[model samples]
Target chain A: MKLLELVALEKRYGERPVLRGVDLAVDEGERVVLVGPSGCGKTTLLRLVAGLDAPDGGEIRLAGEVVSRAGAVIVSPEARGIGMVFQDLALWPHMTARENVAFPLRARGVPRRERDRRVAELLELVGLPDAGDRRPAELSGGQRQRVALARALAAEPRLLLLDEPFTSLDPELADRLRGDLVALQERLGFTLLHVTHDREEARQLATRVVTLHRGHLGEEAR
Target chain B: MSRRLVLGSAVLLLAIAGGLPVVAMLAQAFFAGGRFDPAPLAGLLTDAGTWRLLGSSILLAAAVALAACAAGIPLGVLLARTDLPGRRLLAALFTVPLLLPPWVLAVAWAALAGREGLLAPVVGPGAALALDRFLYGPGGCVLVLGTAFLPVPLLLTMAALAEIDPRLEEAGRLHAGWGTVLVRISLPLALPGLLLAAVLVFLLALGEFTVPGFFRVDVFATRSLERFAAFYDVRGATAAALPLAAAALLVLPLESAFLGRRGAPLPGAGTRRRTVPLGRFRAPALAGVLFVAGVLVALPLSALAARAAAPGAFREALARAGDALPRTIAWSVTGASLLLLGGVLLGLVVGRRELPGWRAVDGLALFLFALPGAVTGIGLVALWNRPATAFLYGTPLVVLLGWFARYAALPLRVTTAHLRGIPPALEEAARLAGASWWLRTRRVTLPLLGRGLFLAWIVGYVFCARDTAIAMLVYPPGRDTLPVRIVTLMANGTPGMVAALCLLATGVVLLPVAVVLPVLAISGREDRR
Candidate 1:
């Protein structure tokens, strides 16, 4: 069975239609990159899959369970075992690096010792061993980016969603982070669905590239 | 007090003033001879007179809210979004009344409508009598209370309008006319705050004792006071207070949610870019703002000034109110100080913890704040009229305590707003750095919230200074706040002298607000730079 499935997904805000009848599917461990023009509903699709929003029509299924359908969520985001790094990173600015990483574990009710151990490992994995003590405001751009990735990976989610997180980074730093992300995916074996406006970055990181034009999805040669 | 003691005591004080009294009254309402019985409450509910009073009260509140929103929302939108001439000056003038006590405004309106009122000579005897009759009933109460409470929505709506990204309007502008864009885009975005303001106005109108009292309107507020002070019926008073409290609780969640979503009263992204051109509307719009100012500010003040100009009348009014003036000022200062101390103690934990249940604290404060002054007075008497608490009940301390309880929420919420704006990452970062909640709050949150706390303090001071309803209910026999004195002297006193006393009360209230305004302006400028 496919790890994720979207069938005839439709959404609108008031009278303005967005994501009209979009359908796609991804197998376990497949890295899918969605490239689209601004306002083409790529982020909306990602948000729906992560259970942040419900669609207006049609259904979304994960692991053969319908998690979302028109106008309601069958499964909540946390219960769906999915993680998302928002376009703005959504790092809890009140939290330090490690606490942001450790938050999912704490929410999952892991004990302090185990939570601390996992947080420390994630920080080292992201090459931010000492940056754990600093807030998102104090951290550099690349460090904050890594902290978001470390946080997404902390709870060992079966699927991870990234929303144009590295768009602000320099090309050199973006390339390095992309390679590191690919390696991390290889080692951990989690499904990745990434949204980007950059064609080169999509080509570099995606196993299957898809173009979203006016809300419809089409396969692109990879 | 230690931080724990301070916090505990502040919460305890909040409980005492906000909860304990209401509980005391409700306890009487729900039980008789120490056995559970809903008979007294049910009696009030079933009474035909009780239903009439409730109906009248609801009608008065609905009329006032509708009237206030009718004026306030449009004014807020025009002032905030349009390039109306003298917009900034008009905005500031409109805001001045929020600091002035409502009864002061009532006194002004009375002066403008009385037998010897501003319009009495101009309109003549028959017309004046007819006007005074309307002004003294539900109609007059609605006009006065609605105008008195106008600033609440005005400030809230302007703040809401300021938050909408200019780009949203710009996007709409491309495909549609400005009118279409405003209706479809800007108005919808500003609707939350406009509605929130209307909700507050409705609650304020319902709880309005002063305007209704001055006008001789027999609404639930007046009825509650009559039940407590006139008939000495504790169960009856509590029974009367029940529905108002229930009304507050009904809307508590929405109020909390709306307030929680916004920052302080003024959140400016930059004033210049948000304004739209008034074009042909400027001259007419300026007339509307001037009319509002005349009705809300100038008429009352000028009436007082004209009244004060009467030979020896001002001094006689002063003599009658004598110590009440000083007492009101002293109690106001002391009350604001107590509220500030308590607010900081309570708010520090609520703001720092960043718990979801913080909304509960906010809702409780607002609910207590929304309770009719008569009910609050009744609650105070029920709780503290005993021999053991007689010392407090005998002094002006009770009135001061009442003020502290009523207005502490204003400051506490302000402090919490400031604390919330301190990014959550700051707390998480501190947590990771091995700092406990206390340490992080002490070292980070408190320092960041200093300005907010100060602003809240100033607001508390002005509100305490101007309050009359609670003071009238809770003040000891010999003591009266300025508001109570001015109100008392209104009956059988010279219209001029009464206006003078009202003006005096207005001055005391505005003093702190005036001092803070320039400082706030300077701070805002400094921030922009």
Candidate 2:
């Protein structure tokens, strides 16, 4: 049931080695939180897994298929069926909340009626049913975060990556969202690979916690 | 009332100097013996020859704009988004053409491709003659003007692309390839700026007269000037210019409708900066950029330099220039200083968006900027040529007014953009300290906006120094700017003298830029440190 695998993945930016011979694997329906200091390559590992970047040296397998190898993306990002919510949410400012959530569905060639239904359903699930017509700029900070999460879930990917999703939120809101995320993941059964600097967020969100320090992984207590 | 008065005065000045003259020219074209008649207007518009000329002009502008975008966009992308080799030097070289006037480019091109050109000895007479023949038509105008204005799209594209949040593209990339992501996300975000650049290039090429005139291309811009000078007929000139004015008027609304007020919002925090990797294409891209820089910019300039290398060329040219050299310097400095002052006032008005009809004022300024110099010239003469207004009409003030009307948009845009980064609270705080408006402006606002105003002044000076049509049309007797003098003297002046004068004029424009850029760079470095 291994959904994603990164075997000795290596990445460097100029002379600086960010991810050196890093190896990790995530099974289906596992909530794996990655904690690291700034510049410790947690985001790099997420990007590599999501196929947004090619590794300098390594092989990445998805469902036992070689998706990337030796600085080449054998499988393109869209074909990888991976969803990522960036730290900033990165919602398209020009799009309404509904359109932002529906983008992935439209991209996947989902029918218009189904896409609308799914978008509405997702908006409702995120507690932003009334915000479908609003732009990212029109939404509150917490509302925008919900929209981003909804967007990431739109395509129904097997693996979902989160990079510091609640880093910008207040403690109360972050705790509330973390609880909601746990419920949603339990219901959906998608593998989660979340990166955050907050230890409490990791402890609360993860079934298993992994620490990435100086381009290597260290397992943490459950 | 004071704020209203301030904004109102600025708008009034624009209306009088820029708007009224154009209206006067249009009125003259459509009226005879104080009666409104469309007969003359219809006659001119219906003329086959007029249409032919306008058609040629449109074709030329379109071709130039198309060529500029075709080259400029790729260059912009490579320079801004890739780790291309020597990109910094290549960018600097490419922008050299923009510093000089279009006519100077035409002159440099002729020196490179004419029968008696630098290439004549190398390529032999027959091929040189063939090249010379090609240089005297629409093809030559497109090459010269396209090269001259290439920086418009180049710089704007870079600016546009720079403003896009990299995360937007990254988000798209998580579900798509770079190509699809670019098309769906990056390009859509950058399209407004790209469109604006293309429109600007088209307007500029359409308004261009000197290069077309030099090449004997007979575009509407030149034809309008020809009509005015040849027959002293304001009506005829206005008829020729109306097409360009109409085109400008049409484009103004379209630009606003498409671009809105948004200028590619600032990139967000934690957005990882990712460049488009040019893995295998790096060398080819660098070669392409360098090839363009060499052919379009370096070659012609080198030819001009060689031709002006005669021992006494500059000395003789300076001697012949007499008071023109000094006069050009004086006029440009005065014009730039005056423009900076006016631009600050107008910038505050437009940027704050507090005054009524500010958008209209802004649109009018842009319209004047886009209006052909010949049209503005014709309009100015019609409005100001009277015994009662002799003081204003007969002196250099008339030319200054024309400069103000023509180049107002430059300073205004600079100040407006600069004003966005400035907080209004500083001025409000000063005012709350019981300081008068003048005191707050002098102490708080002006001091803060100094660098932007300095940049505006330099831009104003560059345009003023190289200005031809406005000065050619409205300059008082014996008060022609150096550009006007060089343009007029190009026909009969010695090769060395003309080349030297071109170099001298270019030098005058670059002098301030050379001084300011390094100072700014040092200041920037200091600030960074």
Instruction: Work out the TM-score per prediction.
Output: 0.69, 0.83
In TM-score terms, candidate 2 sits at 0.83
**Model 1 spans with C-alpha error above 4 angstroms:** A1-222, B1-6, B124-126, B163-174, B257-273, B354-356, B424-443
DockQ of each: 0.02, 0.44
* Tens-digit lDDT string for candidate 1 (B313-405): 778878877898888778888888888778876677577644345555666677777776667777888788889999998887778777766
Task: Report every candidate's CA lDDT.
Answer: 0.78, 0.85
Kindly list the interface RMSD, in angstroms, of each predicted candidate in the order they appear: 15.7, 1.9
Query: Lowest-lDDT window of 10 residues in candidate 2 chain A?
Result: A86-95
Query: Taking the tens digit of each residue's C-alpha lDDT, what string does model 1 give over A1-222?
Result: 599999999988667788889989888999999999888888778878876567999999999999999998788666778877766675654468887788777767789999999999999998899999998779989999999899888889888888898988988998999999999999989999999989989999999999998878876655
Candidate 2: list runs displaced more than 4 Å.
Answer: A1-28, A32-82, A93-147, A154-158, A163-184, A193-222, B1-8, B177-179, B257-265, B310-312, B423-445
A147, model 1: CA deviation in Å? 28
Q: DockQ score for model 1, please?
A: 0.02
Candidate 1 residue-wise lDDT at A221:
57
Q: Per-residue error at B184 for model 1, in Å? A: 2.2
